[model samples]
Target: MSDGADTGEAGEPGTEARPGLVRRFLLGLIVVLPMSAALIAGGAFLYGKWRFNAPGPAAAPTVVWLAPGHGLSSIAERLREAHVLDETGIFRLAVELNRAAGALKAGEYEIPAHASMADIVRILREGKSIVHRITVPEGLTSQEAMEIVRADPVLTGDMPPVPAEGSLLPETYNFSRGTTRAQIVQRMQKSASALINEAWPHRTANLPYKTQREAIILASIVEKETGLAAERPKVAAVFVNRLRKPMRLQSDPTIIYGITGGKGPLGRPIRQSELDRVTPYNTYQVDGLPPTPICNPGRASIEAVLNPPETNDLYFVADGTGGHAFASSLADHGRNVARWRQVEKKAVQVPVKAAEERTAGTKPVIPLKAPARHVGG
Candidate 1:
């Protein structure tokens, strides 16, 4: 009986130990399996980060347009298509990881060569799109300037009615895509008004014009008078001197504006009858400044009229060298006029000399008085 009892005790210990061994094996599996899984997950995260920051495959700068309402998945796909990103999955994962899915904006973007996925992500998040600019050159009539704006392919929407003449500023304007045409016109008008307000206070004292409109009116004439930058201040002085003397301005541009209404340049030279015809804008017949500005004047011309150099010059005539000769007295003006007539005479003879040679002893008739005209005072 004692031998049988000892054998049972030994067998009981073996049975208990088998269960403990099985439990230990299961616990080890639970701990080690999770550690292995965590290591794998961490390695994947680090590799993803490296790929997100790695340079893209684009060989040159690429321009991409992200339209409004584009989802993150679509943006990622587009970036892949444009060769800006290697794969869309990584871009999507990176954007989702950074919590920037909702921060992305729509617009045109110029991506640099070798831009990283991370760099592109930040750019779209901050809405840093490409900037576009259009320049309206100085001295364009309002109608002419509006035509330029209307012709731009980037700007959207129908243009508003043409603004009043000389009300729009002629300058380079910057805008984004999808900007309305009306907004651009408003910006121009605002710039014009702002410039007048800023420059009116600093004008020369005892100027002939009393109001801002009159100053602009005279400035428009100065803008049309000469294309030379150095001559603007001097030309403004001439008109100012004439206004002070109560002498007629007799500007040729003003007469042309009266006939064409600032729609465009008169294709032909001023005829003698058109000069003599009575009109509200005819400076030869009118006593003072015109009723309104003939065209949009730029900042230099506007500023020149406001602070013209002190001078007594009253007359200007073309010098046949794409500029005008200024004179302070009528006698000096007459001399300048005689020299200009010689220049004109030479210009006419060169073209018509062949015809004159066809008929022997017959002189080419180039009228000395108002013989087809040039813009002069």
Candidate 2:
């Protein structure tokens, strides 16, 4: 009986212990293996995210302009070629997620080297871009201004009919790529109108102009006559004095404008015979202001005409000093003209020799004059 009991007890314990150990081993393996695998996968994902989001080295990079008509695929390809973004597929996904495929503006854009796909998409969606500057110098005619506008490759659209003279302002204009020529012209007009309105209230008393247009006409003449900023009001005073005396304005640029038909720049200097031309723009033929302005005048020129300096001087000649010689009397003007003729004669004497010296890259001798001063005599 004792031997049988010991055998049964041992057999029962062995059978129970075997199943309990197996169950424990399997349970531990099932939970630990999955947990370990989960930790590994999480670490890998965190590493990838950190690598992509880290700040990059600072360096100057070239910028690329995305033109107005380029599609998303085209822009992506260009960005990839430039190495701005690592993966075009990722960029496409970002663009699609933001729904910004149609919101991109055509302009000059500066993309940083190795910019992230997300950053590029954000830049496009915001419509931020670089603005280009174009400066229109004072005294250009409307036709001349139009040519400059058309020559710019960034500007777009068909040009409209050229506007009347003095309708545009001369100043620096900021524009975007793909801007229209007509839009530029309109901006100029708006600027001109604003300037005229602001300056009209401050005009000097007893001005001969019956309207703002007349003032603009005279201002245009002053703009074409002198490049010296200090000399503008003095030049304007001469024309104003002439208008007060009901005498001819005798502006040479006006005569040239009539001869050229406003098609292009005047090539040659004015001749004595052409001054006698019967065109309405010829101030020597017509006793009053021309039918319109010959060129666009800037703010300073317009203001100079409206608020002429207190002077009675009425005649001026080039003093060969990059400024003009001013006189109030015919006798004084005659002497000034005589001196100018002497200078011209000397200049003509050595023309061929001067040409040879210029071709050889030698500085030509230029005569200097005394500092400009007011001459009442």
Candidate 3:
């Protein structure tokens, strides 16, 4: 107590030791605050990463539609609503971190079950949408093909005007949802034009047709004459030979088209009165190719017309075997008709009755001098 200075043991408290205690407290705070903050930040980062990689809530594969002009936030919300994701925050974070925020595409997508948030982002950024197809079969008229496009539930918008006959290609066209019907029709037309352009250059020399349109006209007839793929070349050859000989095409489908105007199927066999009618499309009456295509011809039919094989066949009639009996002479064609009438007597009754019933019970007799003048003869 000589100078009355504060004195205490090292562990005891006193006024002089207060400064030391304060220094230690400040030092502890300095070290602990950074450590605590780092721990908290690490925990938050791990949680976000886990959510980003975790399996989604979709029980099965679910379809999600992202409309055009939607931002990233809107897409995330759509994903959450579709149950493809439990939340949107982690998904947004992941997409942003991967530097793919602007790469997401809009369309119909099929998200698989248990797909992680990373998987969803990757799918959208990669534009992996579901593919839908509309198959337009060969020999369908433009009106019929457009009817198919109009009836599709997935495609959007009203159909455009019916295209010209033989102007649209018949194939399985692929598209995503929300595609317009008009766009599909235009695509079909473009494909058809492209095909003709490509095939016209390689056409066989000395074709009877003077223009590409005439080629399409013949191809359309060939398409309707036979449904068998193997018979296309022969049927085309018959017509080509007939054209060279200046003989009548005498096709039944042309007669039907003249009667119905390619609006729909005739739904009955062609009658003699219809065939004898002097319409522009009735090949039996018309001298050469029809004014327009009867129906849309496929690629095979077009190719068959442009590059017919070498043959002298001038006549063809249905042989009751889902094919035609081709002959180079009228006598051979008549014999083939007789054989067909014998083999398909019951099948013959259908067309005969169709012709007779429409014409006041006047029966058609197969003349021996000319080809069989009945349907599928």
After superposition, candidate 2 runs with Cα above 4 Å error: 1-48, 54-60, 67-78, 89-106, 117-128, 352-377
Cα lDDT of model 3 by residue, 1-377, tens digit: 73445433334547688899999999999999999999998998899988888888999999999998998899999999999988888888878888888899999999999899988988998997999999999999998998999899999998799999999999999999889999999999999999999999999999999898999999999998788999999989988988988888888888878888888988877776886679898887889999999999999999999999999888777766667788887788789878876766665556666677669866655422222343223
Highest TM-score, which number? 3
After best superposition, candidate 3 residue 1: deviation in angstroms? 15
The runs of at least 3 residues in candidate 1 whose Cα sits more than 4 Å from the true structure, single-residue gaps closed, are 1-15, 68-74, 99-105, 125-128, 352-377
TM-score list, all predictions: 0.86, 0.76, 0.88
Q: What does candidate 2's lDDT look like per residue over 1-377, in tens digits?
A: 99989887776446768888999999999999999999997887565455445432324464767776889888888776766755566556556666888886666677766555556666677777878877889989999988888788778899888889999999999987778889998999999999999889978888999799999999998998888999999999999998898778888778878988677767777777887668899888888899889899999899999999878788888777678898888899889977876766676666666777889999766534422222222
Roughly what TM-score does model 3 have, to 2 decimal places?
0.88
The global C-alpha lDDT for each of the candidates, from Candidate 1 onward, is: 0.87, 0.79, 0.87
lDDT of 2 at 327: 88
Give lDDT tens digits, candidate 1, residues 18-42.
Answer: 8889999999999999999999998
Q: How many Å off is the CA of 153 in candidate 1?
A: 2.0
Clashing residue pairs, candidate 2? none
As for lDDT, the candidate ahead, 2 or 3, is 3
